[model samples]
Target: MAKHYPPLPISIWRHPAHILAFGFGSGLSPKAPGTVGTLAAVPFVWLAMQYSLMPYLIILLVASLVGIYVCDKTARDLRVHDHPGIVWDEFVGYGITLIAAPDTSYALLLAFFWFRLFDIAKPWPIRVLDAKVHGGWGIMLDDIVAGMFAWVAVQLSYLLWQLF
Candidate 1:
């Protein structure tokens, strides 16, 4: 489905925040923008994993906070709230989803699939939060929760692999 994203012409790409909020242009994909944005985040997730866990956590914390502002400002600029093109939340969420798993490509792939499923399904409280939240939080909260679910799934998958 084509969301009411503003036309991403040269003018839209001119703004740094817009570019960031759009997942460095990955979010602009006409089909499955969220998926594309999450996929684009894998490299970042891997890069962040090069650091120790504490630093990675700190980095994500800062990124999440920054994402709120970027998402908010970009939405306002586009005159469309929670537009599909605004997928910084997906970047943050996907990164968060991989946190509990090993940094190997297999683990990252698991996180990616589980995160995408929970994100698309919007199970339980995810659906509830999406309905009630607004603005930047509205755009982010559901995906964060989905990331949490995916985290659990990723961790479990890791454990199961060890057990076998």
Candidate 2:
């Protein structure tokens, strides 16, 4: 059976945290909000790519920290823990996936696929963390781990491509 969620309140637009936690409205999508939010992050990732890796990592770090607060706050306001509409974690996760990726469209696309796969599959420790944790930390940790898993996959793939 499909799980049902209550419709979001209009106040999501009026609050800065809500706006960001929702991924600038990308999370408002009625279907697959997480995927939409992740896709929405691609442009920002591209923009981050314009700078050196140091800057990109710093931005990713800040975003991850902020995401914990925003996601927790949004979920608390909604009286739901880790509501589906709260997708700031996805944004941070996708960012982590591409930290060392080449500045190419194909690399970005590949990273996206890998990140989504790990996120959705939630293998081993990712699944364990998702189930065991709670609050903002819980909301972000699983995706962060997913991003790390995807990062390894992406880096290995790139290395293999170079070797051939």
Candidate 3:
């Protein structure tokens, strides 16, 4: 059965939290909003690459912390828990997946693939967290875990490429 959600008011665009949580309109895509939101994050990842590791980490930490609140508030306002259109989690997840990744197009593409794979697949404990957790923390935690899994995959892939 197809699930029906409440229609989002057009005025939601005026709200800062809605703007951020909806990924600056990337999440408004009619299809695959999560994928579009992740792609939207690619440019930010490019910018973050200009910073050193500590600064990049700090930025990501702040983004994650802020994401929890924005995502929660948006969900509450929409009266929907973890609505598909709320994709700031996807933005942060993609960023986390690419931390310290090589500043190359291929590397960026690889990280994107790995991040999407883990996020969509939601293996093991990620699935556990998704099922058991709730509210904003629940919305963000599973994707954060997926990002960590993708981060490991990206690093290992780079190491292997270097070795060969």
Candidate 1 displacement at residue 105 in angstroms? 0.6
- Choose the strongest candidate by TM-score: 2
Using TM-score as the measure, name the better of candidate 1 and candidate 3. Answer: 3
Task: Give per-candidate clash totals.
Answer: 0, 0, 0
Between candidates 2 and 3, the one scoring higher on TM-score is: 2
Q: What count of clashes does model 3 give?
A: 0
Report the Cα lDDT for residue 23, model 1: 93
lDDT of 2 by residue, 1-164 (tens): 33688777557888898999999999999999989999999999899988898999999999999999988889888888778878899999999999878899998899999999999888999999988999899999999999999999999999999999
Q: Model 1 — TM-score against the truth?
A: 0.93
| TM-score-based ranking | 2, 3, 1
| CA lDDT, every model vs. true structure | 0.85, 0.91, 0.88
Decide which is better by lDDT, 1 or 2: 2
Error of 3 at 149 (Å): 0.2
Candidate 2 TM-score, C-alpha based? 0.96
1 or 3, greater by lDDT = 3
How many residue-pair clashes does candidate 2 contain? Answer: 0
Candidate with the greatest lDDT versus the true structure: 2
Could you tell me every candidate's TM-score relative to the true structure? 0.93, 0.96, 0.94
